[model samples]
Target: MDSQRRQLHLFFLPYLAQGHMIPAIDMAKLFASKGLKISIVTTPLHASLLSKTIEKGKTLGFKLDVLIIEFPCVQVGLPNGFESYHMATSPDLRQKFLKATTILEHPLGELLQEHRPDCLVASVMFPWATVVARKFGIPRLIFHATSFFSICTSECLRLYEPHKNISSDSEPFIIPNFPNEIKLTRKQLPELFTQKVNDAGLMELYKQVIEAELTSYGAIFNSFYELEPAYADYYKRVLGRKAWHIGPVSLCNKENEDKARRGKEASIHGHECLKWLNSKEPNSVVYVCFGSMANFNDSQLMEIAMGLEASQQQFIWVVKREKNGGGKEEWLPEGFEKRVEGNGLIIRGWAPQVLILDHEAVGGFVTHCGWNSTLEGVAAGVPMVTWPVSAEQFYNEKLVTQVLRIGVGVGAQQWVRFLGDSIRREAIEKGLLRIMVGEEAEEMRSRARELGKMGNRAIEEGGSSYSDLNALIDNLRSHSFAVEE
Candidate 1:
């Protein structure tokens, strides 16, 4: 049995985005640590991002390797480095990037044929993985970088279509047949659920993704069972799909260096950030950052800056660089940096987010509610000011604010594709105040700390996530043996 487990090889295919890739890498590391040979298949550009982490994994004696396939950037008429969705600044470029991923099917299929692993764990974006897995007689597990509650909600919305009767976008409708009485307005729903005339290409892609999930062996979530036990059971029993929860995968990175470099090289030095955090009183700082893909106009950025100032809380704000590479400082209130020099740290690009959040000084997170960010906050045991920007972020916000009760929403009511709605500084200030100060804030912090402790326990020996991971591996090994026989 030990020999068979050692012989098992699992391949992970993550989508070309930071949110997807980071968790996938962590999952791969987890599998490798358990004596399974793990291979991560991705494009050159994406592979480059994981090089450091892979080297570290190898140093720790984990049998981890990366298999790179050429991205069809030239064929799709994109620039050399425009391999990931984060690089696509416009709708046209993003569409072209999606096209390029579709083109990767041939190369990806070839790699799978050459090095057939026992199973394939693929990002939900690549629906073609289902067909490829079938061709090779390998089980494919769909990976969703989200909470069980969100997926359950999505599935419920699909089956019930409860929003169909809403006369106005602002009028809220309850999602039918859910464990929790969740309400969402049409404006907050994804375009797929709301748009009368959806983009034909996008609609088709979504259909493929859904079909892929339905036909795949099962689904893998980067969540802990204890965090959403009801939703986890509901997904498997009600939805009738095989599922596994082996995460808060970020906790796999136990070292400061690993945490700092989890996704990309931090723009600011880790030590410098730590030093700044060390100067602050415990549970006094709010860590503010939108995930890699969120784009805000200058006006919106100005509102955020002002909001942080008005809240009068110590904060570390990570500002994404402008794509065009000019006018970066135009949005700041005059003398804002000078006024808040000691009170705030404005990181121009990527900050060591995991490192920052894990600090005792980081009392609250002002976040876009991206799943990776959401889970990281949960793992860090920090309460949040939820400011969802797009995609399934609104769903995640509900999980934090409504289901978990560890976060406060900033009243962001609309879901645009890329550009965020211009929320006023007042609303932002209010949200921060609710999460960072007062009696309610203390209560929320206590809950967050408990959840964080649960997350840590889930990844430990004999914990829920640990058991799930072992079960998943054993299940795959059994399947492999059956196939051989």
Candidate 2:
């Protein structure tokens, strides 16, 4: 017991985005609960965003600290509050945000040298953390907030370059060295791999991230073995590193019966949404949300709204208004709100997704297929209607619809900031119906429920993830002792 409290300390450097930061906070809380001292390093604003989670950790009797380093917003010529990736309004600004992360190297190095935590667990964004950790002889663990399948697929894409010989961006190509015959078009690949961007700095940062993963002591995945056992095994064989699968970390946020009894649902949106879900029958409502960063043009929003109306399923849709405010007044068709009032609820901004997904009424999800949203939906046992909008989301959609067999696709083949004729109301309605009420819906729902059960069991005592967490703790403890000696 005394040795369990070896005073081992771990510093976490998560990307300053809601999806990345939340999972990092949960991982920290998980470690702290097991007697390790944890500090999450972030900027002042990012720290504030996580204040509630940090406070909750304290309340639960854990030592979880938020160490704030100055963000180089002004130096980087970024607009005020545009410190993180998701805050960027344009692709140029997004590149600037990536550059700003590198500015933390000096301060982070100083902090690491001064505090000298046993290990530094950093998300792939701040690859420089690996250099700083090495300088201080700290074991660096890269936190990939993605699945083993994604990691493996991305790595294979890098090594094989199968897309290079394809005739066009839309041409289908199979990813080599993967556990399965996973095929993707060049358009579905991450932007970094597809072509050179205007921002040299961002491109260089991507290279650095890959290099950091190669050089780090090991990588930690926000996933569990059962979730992707083949990929988990394949990743180790290919990467030749000690990667640990100790997650579904978001499951740490699960509200117990006691909390539910006390009316504590993890509703970040209006309680009215959950209340609306409660009034509906079990496995009836189709919830639609395309993450924080996806911005749909007026045409796209109208098409979606019309599609939902056509589906005739009970629905809850969270709409993110366009950044330039171009489409707010004109986005939805006239009287569309009034028409679907009884069967649908449309939230304008952030919705408490976890709470909604875990609700009985939420039978189907129309998602952008971001990794965070995918994992959350999987954990909640909700099948998805994949409508990938941008970033690595298209690949994530493939993972869900094709690989996992737990989602149906809306056939959104490419990322778009504006609506094109590529996706219409009819196609959107077809996908929604397929996931919500079609022949495959029940089978998909069963697969999702099975995976959800496995995810829950993975985090339980004597489970694979539980053992991995303990193993990580013990490994860090031994490292701390050896360094002291």
Candidate 3:
């Protein structure tokens, strides 16, 4: 905690998903450590998902309070009840969700009026939350749930029409006027902004995003300075917003203080996943998991299984039975599981991803290129074998490969919107072999370690991210409605 900074009464509202909610919860804990009271506004379901963690967090004086919000999936047949992510694919759902939540605005305003917290923090994807903040004159700090690269891509698209048709395989093309590592073929942009997505609800949602981008006074990013200094500097120098990169939100949790930062080779439990890594050789085992939302097609799943076995390396893979509403299972290439079962541990549904990444046995991450996964891997100093699924993952993949040299993307071309065209099985095997077991793999692993150490250093006393967060809170205090404007 920075003593010179004034304490805040913070209200955080995530975009209503596991990935979004987890980080918001972590930030609440961090604010508590600074002796601030935090009110987290989310739906009943989301609150239930985090109940156990909140129970454990009480030791630090953090409070997790739930607020009711409408979920359309319960009324309509959209997947998982969250409208924002699924909105790109469903305009009817988006409009329906917007209407439902619009009814929530006044009740929310009344809640805030009653509580009168000093500041409001929201995920950038949801602008309705921002409206509530504006109504109350509360300072709004939008935390992007993605890399600087994705935000840059969105901003560029909002300005220039020429960079609108680029593809993933196309050569480097500049993002109009921006002086960051932002380049894209129209295809390399998120599928939402692609010309291919014109028929979907993406165009409408993109408009909402542009509006939010123009409005926020402050921003929070989940990256360390060493990982993206140029972009961080660009935001500070050019964007003129109060930006804070205080993250790897996992570190703010009580896990590190439990005296059980898992060492190598313990009987693996949820809390002990990293402990098993302690027993493995350096750069040996591969960590295989996607962000909670990013999973593969049935055919792609088979290819990955073959690839993992063919790499001939140890692996810990999280295999969820179904993804979204894509229910049921894909039959494995017969007997492959039996062959590698002794050398692997397959966790289904959910795994303690951050805890596993912090382990010694984990040498490399096979990620779907979600911004959270990408940043978490970076914070852990784990080099990646990039295989993006969708949303801003393509942007994240570009950041991992081009901006940071610690990872390799397997596909010759990415940013695809179709299902039938997936990467080949042999290609998956070869990519893993190169990134996990070969000499180049060892080199990448060392780079990842160096990067991870730098990220950790940035959060210690007097670290860049630490100082920046303190500054952000100070600015939040100054802008409080209870004080002045």
Candidate 4:
């Protein structure tokens, strides 16, 4: 069985986004650690971003490698190095970026044909991978970078069309047949759900993604069973699909350097960030970050700055750098930096998120509720102030604030492409105050800490995530053996 495991090879194709790429890399390393030969297929720029992690994996004797394909930047009329959604600054460029991903279908197929891996685990974004996998008789597993609850909610929305009867965008509609009495406003839904099919081909692409998941062998989620057991069970039993929950995948990074350099280099030095954190009292500082793809206009940024200032809590805020902007930020309140110099540290780019969250001094997280950040906070035992901006983030926010009861929402009721509506300073201030102090905050922290312990347990030997991973590998190996027979 050990030799058979050594013989099996798997190919992972992650969508070219930070949220998607980071988890896929971690999952690949997990597979490699289990003695499976793993190859991650991505474009050059994305590959370069993950180079350090892959080298570290090699040093640890994991059979991990990367396969790079040239992105069709020239043909798609996108600038060179514009390989990720983070770089797609305009609506026009966003369309071109989506076009570029479809163009890579051919090169990806070539890689699959040459390598003939035992299985292909591709992101849901690349629906065309289903057909490519079928051509070679390879079993493809669709990788969803969100929670089972989000996937279940999305599937229900597609099947039931529950929001159609809502009187207005702001009116709440209950999702029918869900395990929980989940109510969502029409405004919080993704554009694909609310907009016309003919608007921008979004519906067409969404249909393809759904069909790919249906046709694929099974699905993979970056969640553990204890986190969403009911939804995990419902997805397979009720939806009639094969799935596995083998995550909190970020836990695969056990070293400080690995955690610090997980996705990209930290904008601030690790030591400097640590030094600032060390100066604060335990559970006194709130760490604020909005993940990789969410962007806000100047007004929104100003509101966030004012909100943090008004909260009067110590904090470390990670602000995304503008792609094309230069010099001082015009949106900052007059003398804001000078006023909050010692009380706050505003990092202007990527911050070592896992490092900060795991620190004893950091008690609460002000997060965008991207699944990675959500689970990282859970794993770190910190409660959150949920501010979901786009994608399935609103659904995740409900899971945090409603189901898990470990977070407070910042009252963001709308979803937009890039520049979302500004949540007022008062709302942000209120959310920070709720999650960072008092009896309610302590109760939330206690619940979050227990869940964090469960997350840690789930990844250990004989734990749920550990057992599920072994089951997935055994299932794949059995399929390989059957083919050989």
Candidate 5:
């Protein structure tokens, strides 16, 4: 198949989180830009979101063709049709996801036979994807929703044996080959690691990476060379196949925006936030957001509020309003909200984060360092003030602060979680001050800018990331009837 005449099809299954959804959407748009046929598969709930987003895609050169599947989350004790970001309900999310996977094979098989897509790309979290692809004799690829570090840790754990000496709360032994030398606790890894999976009954999910690893044709990670070349190299060398890094997928947002200035499904609430951002000073505002999945307890929330108050910096904070999650002003020092009224924006619930980061007013981002937020921050050319909330975010912090020198994390020691411990007002204030004006801080800002440029260039018409993507397609077709355009 030649470039223009080539008709390529891809099946995308994300873990149903904001970080995963955004990148998948972006990839869809990128393929559209190249004049390829697009079909994105998802649960009915995500299908609604995608259907709405496809209207935005028309403005770019793409239109999303969705294959909606019934979600079996009800069987897993989860309510049906829950939104992508299920915060308070996340504990049951993995199980629901696992249940949903069992439903994928039959429905997905029918869709594939009818549509005949060129390939299937499933989220790393969705273990069943690779299996069905193998049984159907289709080329399969795993999309690394987290990072190379997450994959490394997971792979190493699969290689290790469970000693069976620990109780429910006892932490598993840390695996080797994790770079940057940080410690992980049972609390930090996914809940699956702690639980005894029920393979016979509950959701027959593939909890083992080894199982999916053997089933996949390749894996696609949404990262670039500059950010994680070392780990990327190790992943490819270890996995022994092409692990492609084609990213800054968020940049495709520009390609998807409408002339009316409406972003793809930009909510009335999120647009209002964007309007506020437009009113701020160039490179003077601090954009704060924790991707949809993370939620903070009240004490931690209060400490963070006080720190922002003490920093006396212009900032924004995104939080979910759980019935008990502290109030915006309640956490701050008395009258602090009144004092910083003009300088700060405390946006609870969802916001147009991509729009905010891309704004001229955003100079720095205070984040949980989720992969989506991290890549968006770097792609926007903004430096970071990392306060990692959970999971692989601690390792991501190391990439920013230690390896790449583009961000500063709060804790000096890699205390992944310090729930009983707190970073008070003075420490938060000092950290903010140093991030903005300190010489070493300035150096970080410079690196962030460079990384931002590289990120854009990589996805551009003739860039390294673009070439890598083409190469992957080329290789995948080497044995087949040529790759799709």
Candidate 6:
């Protein structure tokens, strides 16, 4: 058989989080589009969220399959069917959810033995997969659902420990070994990096992941080199490893033929949001969403409502019911919806985020600076008003607002966990105004548009990301031949 015609199979194991799972799905589609057989190993509950994407891949004639393993919910003290971290009723249960996902290693190992894919790609959290891959002699690659910039910053911060001398996390510290002036307050760092809480379990998990990365064959990043060429190069040269920068994976949905065929049926909500956006003026509306897991208290919810109302800019806000402490209507200030009725459209459930951002009417984004959301905003060419809430989001905020220069910060310098510090309406209003109509908004918009164009081109035929993806495919294909021999 011709080398190009040789059969190849790849397995994807994503961390059981929406952010992680979604990008893994997108990566599978991109690979499958190139005629590689792809199977995603996930729980039944997580498989449901991916049904549409999987079906869409089938429609596009991409060889794709979903292998469901039992989710150890009850064992981990989680409610039945609560497989993903986001499915947990509250933020407090997140650790339990993480534990539950870890319990799947045994089951995942059995499945991998059955399928014995040519290569194994897994989320950062599933370091045990590296052991399985090694046992089976399969090439292992870890997928980080973030930008190259985030990886570089996180690694550098971990190595340098620049904040060690600081008495307070709130004190600003300049990060060492960077091409640009990158400064971050100790407070902005993630819990793991802060060195304040010594959770042995968490630290052990981090150690395992770092070891896995060092031992793995390579890494696959859900980011394009064009977006952060300097950092991508730094990651490769310093780490002394081959890292593939093939991303803005959300753009896989931009395949026009597949989109046209299944646009309405694939996502009714996306169509509805786009239709509504069509009525708004160009570059006039602000899009507000805090990602899948970020939650807020009543006061914070009300503050957000007040700020959106105060901004006077047209906006579409995706409000997940449970994420706002469950009582949605009660949380918003009285008469708030009535006042901003026409100017603001509040979506109570999942919003077609990529679709909304891609719309021409979206001018500004009020984001929590999640890596996926940040890249989507960049791909859409919309300037962001960054309000990083928790996790690695604070790190991502600096990448967007400071490194990229396409986003404006909302002064959220600290990681706000559940029931923590609240951002008042004044800060929200100022951030919105800065991104939407302030003197800097235009310049930011221009930069955002430029970045957006670069992101788009990077995924096109013969583009940087496109070439990288093809190279990865070819490398995998060659590996398949070697295995057969």
Q: Which numbered prediction scores highest in TM-score against the true structure?
A: 1
Q: Which pairs clash in the backbone of model 5?
A: none
Q: 81-125 in candidate 3: lDDT tens per residue?
A: 464442433446555565554455566687789888877888776
Q: Each model's C-alpha lDDT?
A: 0.91, 0.81, 0.68, 0.90, 0.68, 0.82
Residues 408-433, candidate 2: write the lDDT tens digits. 88887765542322578998889888
Please give, for residues 72-96, the per-residue lDDT of candidate 5 as tens digits: 6566566666535453243356445
Runs in model 3 deviating more than 4 A are: 1-7, 70-103, 165-172, 176-183, 198-201, 254-268, 271-279, 322-329, 412-421, 481-485
By summed lDDT, which 10 consecutive residues of candidate 3 come out lowest? Answer: 258-267
lDDT by residue for model 4 (54-79), tens: 89989999989999999999998987
TM-score of 2: 0.93
Model 6 residue 447 CA deviation in Å: 0.6
- Estimate, for each residue in 1-485, the C-alpha lDDT of model 6 and write its tens digit: 56688778899998877788777888888899888899999888777767777787787798998999998878978778877666655434766776776788888789888988899999889888898888888899999988777788888888988889777877888878886788888878877887665566677788898999989989999888878988899899986768998888889887533333321132235566767888998999999988877878777888888888887889998775643454547778877777887788888866667878888999999999889899989999999999887778888888898888988887787776533347889989988998888679999999999999999999999999999999988898887777777
By lDDT, who's the top model here?
1
What digit string (tens of lDDT, one per residue) describes model 1 on residues 162-227?
989889999999998888888999999888899653467678898899899999999999999999
Candidate 6: count of backbone clashes, pairs at least 3 residues apart or interchain: 0
Q: Give model 5's TM-score versus the native structure.
A: 0.84
- For model 3 the local lDDT of residue 290 reads 71
